[model samples]
Target: MRTLRMILLAGMAASALTAPSAGAAEVTALDLGAATAARLAMGHVRFANGHDYNATVGFGSGAFHRPGDPPGTLYAVTDRGPNIDCAEIGAVVGMSAEALCAGDTAAKVFPFPAFTPTIYTLSIGDAGVEIVDALPIKTRSGRPITGLPNPLTLTDTEGAFDADGRPLTPDASGLDVEAVARAADGSFWVAEEYGPSIVHIADDGRVLVRYVPQGLEKDLAAADYTVKGTLPAILAKRKLNRGIESLGLSADGRTLYAALQSPLVNPDTAAYKTSRAVRLLKIDAATGEALNEYVYPEDEAASFTADAKAGKVKQSDVKISELVVVGQDKLVVLERISKTTKFHLVELGAGASDLLGSPWDDPKTSPSLEATPDLAAKGVIPLSKTLMLTAEGGPFPEKIESIALLDESTLVVISDNDFAITGDQTKVVRIALDKPWN
Candidate 1:
């Protein structure tokens, strides 16, 4: 069985997504169990509800690398702590389903209610992955910010509960950070899902300014950090929990690229589930203004041959997970289903339509951009894409949310383990291309 598995991985590694392929790509797997074991040994995590999750680091939320960082050294961020929806609360916590989940708002159970999201500096080597340093995301007052959902007055809000089935209050400062990009000055820009917001943090981990969709400023007024409503108003219509999930920063740190995880519920939820149009934005890093917006069409569900043969799947299953900047106007977009992942090289200049102020961005437009059946028929041109890599089956783990390039010819991918909520372990895969990406 081991020999057969190795042969399968070798074959899969040789498959290149782009044209003019070289030879087989080198593949390596790094297990993060050592970091988890080390954390447990030091008692780094304390569960308030008495439920020991035996959790992993959950470092796959986002990844970043400064221009001059050493090879094999990258930074990763964690999402909201170990949590499960209401449906599994009964079995996982051995508690009544109605106690915390049956109220006016359904709440997710957080085993570590006070857990804060953190940034980890990782060293990837032949032996395994190592955690060299860690930084906690905090507020200006130096108070660590929890991962709980924010209490917003304008848009939708999700509630949360502690492990003991105790309802937890919504915090305006809470952030469900999904992606991070480091600035030249050593500060950080993070993409979040709760307010579906973008936040700028200082070098010491203090939030400098948070930019949300227009009209959300009033909602986050009480937040300790400065809040700005600079993003387009239409972005507020994004599907719940499906917000900005991918972010990339230019080497000069003057521009940023951000993408929504899935199509927005422009017309309604039905349109969102069936739509292929995903919004990607190019923003001015200094001003937080969206300079341009382009539509990124996701792949059809039937295209994933192996996954479709197993069972039924829908277009909604495909989502944008991460974005990596490779050139001045070029990026690598990571989109995936649960079992299959694809990396596409996308260029921002020319031949692509910028829909910044078009009707597609207007909230009052009927049959919204997401609902439009044919954008080409309306003279709209989405970004042109070239497939760079298609990874599935052996050596590729599910829920791969973060990706980075170690060199011109090497790619690094990380999978989110959900803090071992379902017995999943955080895994990292390193792929050395036969030829350089340039």
Candidate 2:
């Protein structure tokens, strides 16, 4: 049966290549060697309203429009259990497409237990983010496992449920979630925009640890010299503290770098001004302590903000979507505007003494120094190289929300189909970055 399932899956994948399409410009065929050399892997989730189905693919040419795909074609693995009334969207990783398509018992893979029901970004390789086999997660109660959805089933697939099988929705108070670093051990650390700021989950969907930003608040206040908002409130705000948007970790996993999806307000400002600068934070992973926090230079911030105010930018929000530590001192940042994507190569240097400066003292005006001294004291860094608009003019204009490195030269990008009434197309795109990032 397993052998038969594998054969059928291969055939289905082959057929997928020729799936009917509305005529659009043909994209360059993916170079598998370049993709493999870059060590990229791609995956995405799908969102469907009754009339149309959209599947978001990771690292593909943004969203592809397929007006005729079946409603239950895409699948997502959730933390809810089987007894709970939920839709079976698709098979989890390692399940055969044939078995999933058949909706048979043999198609059953794993079950997600105690994992938070939310959207997640996955990593492709071992360095920062990588895939993991079915593994038990450490829990306060006991050991818990992950599960996959049966793609063939088409019941209620939209929302996640609680232990009582009640549907769990993002509350009226929006919840913030950001994909942090993929650990060397193949697990992922997610920073929340709300309280209990950190959550570590294994790839198979098991909760490991939840870190609350309690102890770090005092230090963060001391470093930035402002404390109008709590850690949780900063994370929960939809426009600003868009929870854990970017994650960067040291090679050894001791230090962490985080960026918010939107600009953090200067606590002193009455009508807070938004800056193009991305916040760089150094965290102690073991203790969940924010040792230092710094902002990118005002010059860089002005470059992007000026364009945004002039309506010359594709996206209004200068969100840092993804972060990867290249070496000890180098970091790769993926910046997303509505239709444009930019890659920035940042260089880490010594810490600064006054990272906040006048921003903490007088929010109404700009600071004297282009850069903050506290950031230097806290070991904040600068961008050494940058790549802008690397992948544009593809199938659908992308709102890239997640990214993973397949290898040194390949990257998998995922688009979030925001579950709109108009039926947005979700896409996963694979790009081969063969050239130097300068």
Candidate 3:
């Protein structure tokens, strides 16, 4: 595999990867390697915590699309820092939850409790990729926020330890920021996996407000920042680690669209795994209120990683990593299930039914949205989707987690490098769409 990686790198140096769009049209690509001083800083963190930095520079999880920026300039975000497998954890498996919080932490990953999610301003071109500037997300009081998980009382969570196997407590301000969008006022809206919440960050990175599910609004209100439970209450059923994963701002910047990573744990895990209907929430950014919800149905599997398709893995493999608003009411959604990543042009037509807090949410409904024999027959018109491109047979990165608009005619993509684990490298790919509006 290392040799293949070397050969791949050699080939990459000679030519960038290219893949076909629909029809005879092909989306040409320009690949840029990202190098930053941040890797050296993380190297120290790795040695101290026994957590190796997989990639050279690790800021490649979520993406923030900034329109009208200087050409070749784009923004991307990093999620909670590098994580390790359970077997890689440095502690005993069955330690008491209480004991896990009092002592020092020995967690193989997250040993540095102070690791913060970072936003990167990337300048990408044929020359290469470089960080123009970086911003560290912080709390309302101007304190840096960690990437650690929130406490279990508020939601499902995991305990933390240090490299030597000691206990650590949860931090309320911790955020696993996945999707980001820049607001007109220079502030930002970030979608977090923890609260499955939408957080407002001042231009300087202070958390201004957070909107989460209704039931937990009060639970997290007393934190050192503002918290509101304004998203649809049904969102409370969001599956673990599979909350809002992608965010986009409407052209006018008045509306925010958030895509759930996978099906919610509404009826049960079994139902969620096989369910195809994932939810997309349209929210009023100013009020932090859910204006409407649309469904993106995962079609019957015609293609999937053999393992995932063979029943060796859970059926909840399909996920939405990032979505961008291209046309007036049309969204360019990046959908993937394992090695196959496809871009779909979805339109939020006004004729579609609003599924927020609808009967489809009732656990008792015989035909769950996932099981609905025919959504259209029941007057439930899903957001119209048109195939744009598929990377199944293309030269694309493994985890293209974020996408942004470089201009009305171009799109840019970034992949989470997992710090380069398994030889995956962070790359910036410039895609000139066949149709900018598509």
All candidates: TM-score: 0.92, 0.52, 0.85
Candidate 3's displacement at residue 330, Å, is 0.9
Q: Report the poorest 10 consecutive residues by lDDT, candidate 2.
A: 1-10
Q: Indicate which candidate wins on TM-score.
A: 1
lDDT by residue for model 3 (337-416), tens: 65567788888866778887788766677667766647788888888777666653334566788888777766777777
lDDT of 2: 0.39
**lDDT scores for all predictions?**
0.80, 0.39, 0.70
lDDT of 1 by residue, 214-271 (tens): 9998888878889999888888888777889999999899998999999998888899
Better of 1 and 2 by TM-score: 1
User: The CA-based lDDT of model 3 is what?
Assistant: 0.70
Question: Per-residue lDDT tens digits of candidate 2, residues 1-438?
Answer: 011111111112311111011111122222224333233222222222122222221222111111122221111111212221222323222323233323332222112223323433333322222222222333333334222221111111123333222333322111234454556665656665443245566665455555543333332232111122222222222232343566666767677666655544443222123444445566677765566555543223324432455565432255676666666656667776655555666665544332433233233434412223344443444334444323333332356665544444444555654432124433444444434332
Q: In candidate 1, which residue pairs get closer than 3 Å at backbone N, Cα or C atoms, i.e. clash?
A: none
Pick the winner on lDDT between candidates 1 and 2. Answer: 1
For all predictions, the C-alpha RMSD in Å is: 3.6, 15.2, 5.2
Q: Model 2: how far is 24 from its true place, Å?
A: 23
Report residue 303 deviation for candidate 2 (angstroms). Answer: 6.9
